[model samples]
Target chain A: MRWIRETGPVVGAITLALGVGAIVTALTGYSVPQVFRHLAVGAFGDWYRLAQTLTQATPIIFTSLSFLIAFRAGLFNIGAEGQLYMGAFFAAWAGFSFQLPPVLHPIVCLLFGAAAGAVWGFIPGWLRAKRGANEFVTTMMLSYVAINFTSWLVAPGGPFHGTAWANQTVRIATSAQFPRLLRGAQLSWGLIVGVLVAFLVWYLLFRTPRGYELRAVGQNPLAAEYGGINVTRNMILALTLAGALAGMGGAAETLGTHRRFIELFSPGYGWDGIAGGLIARAHPLGAILAAVMMGALRAGGQAVDRAGVAPADLAAVIQGLVILFVVAPELIRYFRRLVRRKKLGDIEL
Target chain B: MEILSFNLFISALRLATPIALVALGETYSERAGVINVGVEGMALAGALTTAVVAYFTGWPWLALIAAIGVGALLGALHAVWSVYLRADHVVSGAAINLLVLGFALFLTRVIWGWRGTSPSAPTMNAWILVGVGLFLIGLSQVYIFRTPWGLRLRVVGEHPRAADTAGINVYRTRLAYTVLNGALCGLAGAFLFNNLGRFTDGMVGGRGFIGIAAMVVGNYRPLPALAAAYLFGFVDALQMRLQDYIPSQFSLMLPYFLTVIVLAGFLGKAQVPKALGKPYVKEQG
Candidate 1:
């Protein structure tokens, strides 16, 4: 019952988006039911499909929670893409360059990833906290810096170049790789760790004094300040924490899946995470389910193209619409109310 | 003597054209108490519209008018949702950004049957557009500071209640300016492709976002924002020239790095309009 109530709006949003998608599919001269059937089968047809879906979900779960934390503090950290790149790059660099005990190697690499992301995150947080800079613009500008700088770093003949022709770093040491969870499958402990982080974030936000201060700052900063909470400090702390989570996600993706940092490592996973946060309404634990839903869409995106059902970019369109509906639920409600009024009077519909 | 070269000056103006128009548009909307991050999307859509019109008809002026129409339509969509429903300003902007991006990319395949770029179209003389943009900025400065309509718009941003009490329709004023802002952004988009002579994927290249930063760095005023746009444009041109002396990446990062430094140093002193980003409830107003 609780789950139903919590996901009520998300379900409505998905339904609306699918309705729009169906219309689009029809316009392309395809059967909507067949397209959806293929989508479901492609995302969850077998054990292999399930693993692919979960793999697609893990990183977004991490970044969505990152957005969730910053959002709860009334700060928008849209720079998750930049932080993810920093995290992935540094983690891969540490994984390849370091000589450590097998067990310690992965841990050190992951830590470096989080630290790099934190530094990236902290810049905008500090600017917003100490100065009055809007993180929206500052973080965005820095994202280009991150993208171009990373591109240059990995370009052939550039620093951090590996032995390959591709613009990427050397492969990580075997000891640094995440242990696979299943035989013949790429699934690893990374998915479990992602879910665990969600729970931990929930505990931190709801059951701790510092979390209370963060929420207070988010809810009413002037009131929080008047009540003796250090609003400025909490704002910076929340954003930094958010960045750390995104960094961890990037590390998990690099260490668990690719085992190296490559150019265009993310297929806009950061933006997908932003959509996840909105779908979850900034709830930490809820981000897990939202991430999986997004993952299925991503998997379905490929399926539709392969099956000749629709364009591969249909997922992007649907995700965008889902964000629209979720961010402004009132838009749906207002339309619904108008429909009801019309039905009660002249029955316009 | 070389620093004052006519070629360098022209290149700087060329680089600054899109950023200048976007910054001016952002300044207007922000002053009207609406934050429209959709400038990025609007600009992209406008560019595509320009490319399509220019490619098929070879009429650059028609493309300009069409781009403004597209921008206004998008701006109206934002205004209606934000003004009436009081949607979360930033979130709504992000939604528009996402939807417009996907929609524009999807249209490329449908219209041109090409992959990521449009066919190179003929470009017209763009010096007239740059002159028009500079003239508009100057005119807007005077109109905003010295005109009665401009005072009403500022009052709506700074104090909606005062504007309401003074018989000004705050909602209508905000909606009007927001639509106008979109038109300006559309103009900026048209300039981008017209100057470049073609449309490429991701051609806006985050200039829409950079323009927003410039508006803030300039204290959200048109004159200062125009100067900020030129400064950013100068860095872009300087970076290209510095490629011979330094690693190109370092040069590439100059504008962004400088923007951050400039923002950090200036933001604390910059005061946004008081009612900015807040939805004005009719009762409260």
Candidate 2:
């Protein structure tokens, strides 16, 4: 009953968003029913589509977890995109540069990715904690810097540029790549790892004394400080942990899916993760489900493209509307107040 | 001497126009205790409107007005969410950004059979807008600092309860300034469209964020904010020239890096309004 009450608004927002998308589709001279049918078929029609949906769901799960942990600590780590890129690049670099045994190779590369992301996260964290800088702007700025820095590394004359004509690194060794779970689908062990990490994050955020301190800081920093919680250290720790999580996501993408560090690889997965975290109301377990929903929308958008129903961007429209509706639940409360006021006036008359 | 030529100076001023306009607009909104990070999306929406209207009507002035109208509409939406609905300002702004991007992409694909780019359209003189922006910034300095209404605006943001006690309408002031901010962002978009005579989704890029940075560097004052915009504009112009000697990617990172550094140095020191980002709840009798 509690779960249903909490998710009631989320469900309503999703339904409203889809309704808005349908209206948009109709206005654009497309059949709404056909477009939605294709969306459903594309997202869950068969094993292959289901695999694709899970595959898409994998990275966002990591990023959403990243957003959630930082949010719980009273910080916004929007720099997951940059951290992911750094992690992916380093993970790929490790994959191609060294020759090691099968199990150990991927493990080392993942560690390298996480370490790099931690370093990236630490800079803005330290700045915010020590120097009174705004993390929101700093994280965004650092994201642009990381993107450009990585792009330069893969461009024609950079050291990491592979012999391939495309601006991508050489493919990782077979020993470093993640084994595929399905015979003909893109799904890999990354999904399993992502789920495990989500559970771990839930435990850390809810079942630990440290987690309590962090939540206290988010709730009231001055009070937390007076209560003997080191607000600065917690802020730094939260962003660092957030970075590591996003870094692992990037590493998983490199090891399990891409097999190479491609230029400009992310399609705003970081931004999608922000929406995911909010949709889940910062709950770790709920983030996984929200991420899957986002992934399904993406998969369905691709399907819409193939079926010639409408442009794929229609999916983004629904996602945005969902965010707008979810964030403004107060709008509903305001309407309720207005109705009550009208009733009071009628009674007076 | 070769790098700081007359052309570079002129180009710097031109590049500074949009940032300065956004900074000026943000100054107003922030002064009224509302943070409007949706400037990026508002600008993009404005540019898209300019292209569509200009393409159909071939009237640049009408396109500019439409851009402003669309921007004001988005601003009104944001005000409703943040002020009345009491949503998080940043989240509401982020939603507007995402919504605008999706709508821009969809419209482009639907109308022009292109995903993100619009064809060349009829345009007016972009420098005219630049001149107008500079003029507004100058006038705003006087209006904000040397007028009776300016004191009321400051009081509303700094001590809203007091302002309300003094019979000033806090909610109306905030709504008006947010809408004004959005209209200014639209004008910035119109300038971009006029300068290029075309529109692309990525054209606005991070200029809007940088504009906010300039506002901080300027200490929330209009004239100083314009000066900060000019400094960033100079770096942008210099980077374009330096692109011949260095990788464009490395040069592109300079402005963002400088913004972070500049913001880090200036954030805590800025005279931030006392009631910034806090929703004022009126006590019912």
Candidate 3:
């Protein structure tokens, strides 16, 4: 019953968002039913499509987990995007620079990437914890800085620029790459790692003493402090962990999917993580399903575009609408009040 | 010496116009106890409106009006979500940003056969808008500080229950200021269109967020906010010149990095409104 109660709003929001997508598609002179059909077909049309969807879901799983952990500790780590970029670049650097055995190489690259992301996360965490800075602004500003900084590093004349005309590093060594899960499919062991990490997060969040303290801080920081938990330390820990999660995701993308750090490759996976975390009500286990749902939308969106049914951008509209509806369940209550013709006042949930 | 010439000052003012306008708008909304992080989306929507309208109608003035209307509409929607529905303000604002980006891109592709750009359209002089922005900032300093209405706005934000007891309409005041904030963002977008003579998806870039940074740096005051925008604008101008000596990527980073440093410097010192981000409820007798 509690699970249903918590999940009811998210389910309702998804349905309504799809309805809005239909309307927008019709208004844009596309066949609404065809768009929906294509969306379904594109997402689960065949084994190949399913593999592609899972491939797309892999990175978001990491990012949403990053957001989930931070949100549980009352922090918003919007810098996940930047952290991901840093991780990707560093992972790529490690991939090409070393001559290690196959099993050892990927591990070293992942650690280097995670460390870079952790450092980035630590800066804002320290600032918020020690200097009383708002993590919201600092995280956002740092995202832009990291993006530009990484872009410069890979552009022509930079230290890591590849010989290729494209703005990307040289292909990472094969030994550093994650083994493909299926022949003739882009799916890699990265997805398996992401799932394992999700299980780890669920255990950490629900079955650990540290998790209790973190949630207590999120619920009421002053109360947590009075209860002897170090609120500041927890805040720093949450963001640093969040950064590590996102960084590992970036490293995975480079090693498992792209095989190199491509410039401006992310199509807002970090932002998608926010929506995914919210859709899951911040449950670590639920994030996997939410990520897969988002992946379906992206994959289906691309299919629709290819079929000329509708632009892929419609997925974004649906996503934004989902966030709006989820955050404002009061909208439903307001309509209910209007139906009853009652004067506006707070209604008990 | 060439980099520090009179042209730099002129260019700085031009670059500062949008940021100043956005800061001024944010000052009004934040002063009235609303945190509208959707300002970035509002400006983008405004820019899109100007391009779409101007492309079809060939009337710059009409396009400008449409842009402002679209911005205000988005603002009003945000107000409905954040203010009336008691949603998380940042979450609602993020939604607006995403929705507008999707809408803008969809419209561009549908109408122009391009993903995010439109052909050059007839545009009015952006400097005129800059001049008007300066005047309004000057007037706002007085309007926000000296007027009874301004005091009412402040009172509503600081202590809404008291303001309610005093017969002020707290909800209405919040709604009105948020709408005004949206309109100002629209004007900023229009200025961008006029300056560039067209529109691209990335035209607004990070200026909207930078504008919020300016507002914080200004301590939520109009005149000081404009000054903060100008300072950012000057750095922006200087960075363009420095691009020759350094990598453009590093040069591009200066403004964002500076914003982080400046915000870190100002965080706890800024006088935040007491009722900011809280949903006010009327008690029954």
Candidate 4:
């Protein structure tokens, strides 16, 4: 029943994307059906394709969950992108610089990544909660700084520049790398871990008193403080946890794929997760579905490119439309209200 | 030494123009009570439109006008989402950025047959636009703080109920400012690319957000924001000139790092307008 209600808006967004894509296809003299057919086959044509989708979806799940938590706490933690970079960098530093024993190496690296991310998250949280700084601007600035910082660190003669000159760190040891789940595909065990983390987030949000405080603060900080909730502390905690989650995403990506930290590693997975959380209405479990859908679209874009119909950027357009279309219901309702006000002959709308 | 200093100062002003214009626009919106997070996306859209139109038409001036028009439309789209739909301001803004990015790329491919970069067009000596933007910034100080209309807008932003009770149209004021905000952002972006002679992906490079940072540092005031933009422009220009002295990436990171520092240190000192993000609904008497 819940899904039935949600499907209307979700379907509306999908329909709008498909409708627009079809119009463009028809105008450009391409087969609309063929484009879609390739889209499906590209996303799920074989086990390898499915694995690739899962591989892409893993980071999104973590980042979406991160956004979901902070958003639920009424704080916009736009610093997830920066936090993810820190996480990946710390994880890589641990993997390459340390000579830990085989069993403990990956675990320590992941932990270091989470800690780095949490510290990054905490600063903006502290500023926003205590100093009245806007997270929107701070996070945006921090992201550029972090990206460039990483670039500098990986540059020649800098701290962690690899021999390849590609602005990357050296590959991690075998024990520190995430084990693959499939024979030939790059799918890692991180996919399962990401799903487990999703479950943990669901439990934390719905079944914990700390979660109650965060939600209360988000809903009404004044009322929550009146009710004895530490609003400032809760806001900070919310951001810290969110940063930790996003950092783990970066960790998972490095441990799972690439096996090393690279500058500009993410193609906006952190930002895309914002769209994922919105599409899922901040539901923890629902984010997995949203992430996978986005991953499929990305895969479909590759297929479209291979088919010579459109560029891979069409995927970005679909993601963009998903966000724009998600708001379509509200737009329609607003217009309807305007019409009703006009019918009543009211001077103001 | 004098010639070098003059060249650097001129380059700084040129670099600062877009930031100042966008910050001024954002000041108008925030005073009327909206943060207008779509500034970056709006700027990106304007850049693309300006580049494409100039490329094909041989008229860089028309491109400038068309860019502002497109930016205003995008801003209006955001206004509709924010004002009428009563959506979360940040959410709407983020979505607008996402939409514009995809839409801009799509348009880029359609117009230029390439998604990476557009061909160079005729450069409009943008120093004139810079002068005009600065003049407008000076004029807006009076327009916002000294005029009766500006007073009403301020009241609506600070206390919409009070403004509404006093017979002011809070929604219209905010909607108008938000659109104007978009126009300035459009001008900022158009100016950035017009002088550069082409559009490339990621060319806006977070300048839109830096404009927001400038507004915060300036306490939502025009003169302060212009000054802040100049400071930032100076840092950016110095970094460009110091490419051999420091790692290029480190030099490039200075503006973002400094903005963060300014924001962190001035967190409490700088004040935002009250009722900035709240949606106003008329209560039944």
Candidate 5:
């Protein structure tokens, strides 16, 4: 019941905002009704679109879960982007460099990718926990280093370079590809893995002793310290787990979707995870749902591009609005209340 | 050899000016206890606005003012979200980045009808702009450390509760300094546009992040921040000059790589403002 009340206003506001956006578009010379109709059809008009949205949602789920975990432990983990890239790079390396049985290959590649992301995440987490450095700056800086390093690896004369100047790596072996869960659709076993991970995260955070300690530290590190929990170790562990999840997201995207490591493959999924985690209020299930909505918006917006209407930059606009509205609901509520009170005053007169 | 060194020094100075200006701008906001992580977004907005305004108006100075105004608008939005609404500063900052990026992309497509926008340069060259930047840097150091307002801002950062007890309005001070910071950051962006003669999407690149690094490396002192900026500038200039010797990719990444190493090594001991990133809520005694 409490959850219903909390989410109710968000849903209402989003619907109203969408309507307003449509009206604005109509007034400004685009057919808003047609655009929305097309978007609905394009996104869920068929099974293919549904599968594509689901497939896109899969990586977002992992990354958003990663963000939720770190945030729960009071760590920012801005390096998730870098960690994801590292995971992709490692997954690609494992997939392309090795010859293994089809049944075992994808699993091996994913684990390697997870390990790489964990290592990437661990650098800043350990630094913050042990040395008391600011995680925000360290993690953000690491992102650049990771991006550059990945670019360097795929450049000519680098270890993972493709045989051309096109700035991409060789395609992975067929064995390393994630098996399709649905025929004729891009949906893969990765979606199941992502859902399972979300449940595991929910269970770990809500039903475990370590989860209690992590939350305690997040709420008040000093209190947790006084309660005898190893705060630094927990911080490091939280970041490691978070990075592993994000790394798996990168791995899933590569092995399940692209099958090759390309420079700048991500359209800022890690940053999107930040927004997703915040929107979901760091709940595992909520993060999954928000990730899907975001994925849908991205896919639907791309579909709308085909229908003209300038594509609308709706994803970014909605993302910004959601954060603004969620964080400052009082602004909307106060205004509404003021209007109501003024109307009442006028009626009394 | 002397001329070579002189040219190197000039190049380093040119690179350092924008970073130093942005860092100094950030100093005011941070001193007033607000971490202006939107510096990147603000600078980007300022750069794009300045480029467009300068291109049409044929007046570089007016363009600078427009950039400052745009930056202040962005700062106001951040202040409302982070300070007034008491949202997470980092989250608000990230949203601002996304908003600016989206807006810039949309405006570019609508106005320029191209995927990218590049404006022609005015009369003032990079060297003249570098001179102006140096002058601004000197002025900022004096104004930030020496003024009464500066002292109050610093107090707000160091001990907001005490400052409040001393009858200072922490919120107002933060608002004022954030606007000031935005203007200075705008100036930095304007320099990039009017001086460099063209605008690229990645023009600001990671310089805004580098400015944050410089702030930390300098221990939040203005002169030291300038020195740190110059140090980074030297590395950047050196990378450009040595691109033939070193792989350009490695060169391009040099500053960021060094930042990670330096931050990992030294930032453990760096003491930030006590009230940084914490919204000030006046406590009733």
Candidate 6:
């Protein structure tokens, strides 16, 4: 029964996505079946494509988990985008600045990224917990600050500047890169890390005392205080952890794929993670699945464009439709049942 | 120095006008107990609609009207989902943003055969619109404070159940204010496309978000919101003016940095509408 309830929304969402694909195909003058086939082929037809999809999905998993962790503690950490960028900047800095042994180098860079992200996350968390500030507005403002700060840091004549084609930082050392898990594809060890983090998050939320306290505080801080939970401490810890996860995602994208820190590397992945977390209702495993679906749409949308059927914007349409359908499954089901009943009456009468 | 000062003032006012309009729009929604996170998407849809209509018809006024109508329609969709259906207002707003973005992108590609819409637009005199926009802002401030409807709206925002007992139609008031909010945002978008003589993909780039920050810093009051918007515009103008002296990127970051500082400073003391993000469900006896 629990499984049925969970699958209900998922099935509704898939149906909605399919309906949208059909509409897009008709509008764009392409065959619906062919477009679907092309998307499948482009995303998972072969080993290479599957690897690409996994790689694309990896960073999102981390960021989505980050969002989940904070949300579980009743914190809306909208600064994840800024945190991710800052983490990437720090990781890139550490990667290029030092020449440590291969194993230690990557570890150090990852830690550096995590630390940078945590600091960024901690600011809003501290302000909100201590002064009763609204986290949403503060975090949103921080995102712009982070983006501009990073851009300035990487521009020519800045500290992190390299041989610049545009305003960007230098590439990291070869040893600093996350080791590739497969040859001829971009899949790296980051996917394993992302999966491990998801399991760890699940454990932390469900099996740990700290998690209980955080959840309690989230449910009702006043009551949690009566229960002897330190609400302020939990709030700060949750935001810091959330920031670390998002930062790691940023580091993974840089080390595994781009190999360099660039301005605007994220096409709003942090915001996408927020959407993914909300869709999953802050469940760890659910977030992983939701992130993958988002990643698939993005990865496959590229193929949809190449198939001479639709443009990249079609993917956005499908995404919006999926979210709408998921949130209001009853409406879709009701309409479908209405249509079916009408058809049945026509046949019998 | 004289040339630079003249250009800075113009650019500042130009940048400030749109943000001021959007923030003022949000002021009403927040006061009426709805958080309008779809401002970015609303602006995008409005700008795109204005560009397309103005391009074919070559009538700036009609295009402006179309933009406002479409924005209100989008707001209606938001109201139906968040207010009537009782969905999470923030999530509903996010869904609307994604929907509008997707729809705008699709329609732009289909109608213009261009990846992004960039139509040749006729220029409307900025001074006229700016003056009118400012006047409206002042009127909204006065109307929101001095009128019975304004008092009712505030009562609804602060405590919907109490307002309901007092015979205020909470849902209807919220719906009306949200629609009006959408119109103001649409006007801002029109200013971007027509006043600027052209529109780009990033024309309203993060101004919607900045407008939200302005509202927060302003404590949701109309005059203070305008002041915050002007402060942001001043920084933005300064950045452009000092582009020669400072690194352009750092200069560009000035407004955002100020947003962080201002938010941090004012957030602690800001008094939000008590029932701001809460939905009011009528009790069954």
Which candidate leads the pack in DockQ?
2
The CA lDDT at A61 in model 6 is 88
lDDT of 6 at A23: 83
RMSD of 3: 2.5
Q: Which ten residues in a row have the lowest lDDT in candidate 1 chain B?
A: B107-116
lDDT of 1 by residue, A30-56 (tens): 688887887888889988878888888
Q: Could you give candidate 5's per-residue lDDT for residues B214-277 as a string of tens digits?
A: 8888787787888989988888888787777766778787887777676667776666889998
Stretches of candidate 5 off by over 4 Å are A8-35, A163-165, A181-185, A312-314, A329-349, B1-4, B116-124
RMSD of each: 2.5, 2.0, 2.5, 3.1, 3.0, 3.3
Docking class of 1: medium
* CA lDDT of every candidate: 0.83, 0.88, 0.87, 0.84, 0.79, 0.80
Q: How many clashing residue pairs appear in each of the predictions shown? A: 0, 0, 0, 0, 0, 0
**What tens-digit string does per-residue lDDT give for candidate 4 at A1-349?**
9786776667667777778767776675667788788888888899998888888888889888888899999988666787888888888888887888875888888898889888877887887888777777777787787788877888787899986759898898887888899988878977887899999998988899998899999999999999999999998898888888888888988888889999899988888788888887888998899889888888877888888877667778778878876755676455556788989987873
| TM-score between candidate 1 and the true structure | 0.95
The model with the greater DockQ, 2 or 6, is 2
Q: Which stretches of candidate 2 lie over 4 Å from their true place?
A: A334-349
Regions of model 3 farther than 4 Å from truth: A333-349
Reference-based TM-score, model 5: 0.92
Model 1 segments more than 4 A misplaced: A1-6, A25-34, A182-185, A339-349, B1-5, B113-115
Model 5 chain A scores worst on lDDT over the 10 consecutive residues at A311-320
- Alpha carbon deviation, residue B169, candidate 6 (Å): 2.3
lDDT of 1 by residue, B1-285 (tens): 455567776688878878888889888888889998888888887888889898899999999889899988888878877877788778777778877777665556556656447887867677778998899899989988899988988899999989998999989988998898889888888988888887776888778888988888778788888899998888888777888778787788898888888888887667688998899987832
Clashing pairs in 2: none
| Lowest lDDT block of 10, candidate 3 chain B | B90-99
Model 4 alpha-carbon miss at residue B141, Å: 0.8
Q: Which DockQ value does candidate 3 get? A: 0.72
* lDDT winner: 2
Residue-level lDDT tens digits of model 2 in B82-192:
888888787788778878988888889999989989999999999899999999999999998999888888888899999999999999999988999999999999999
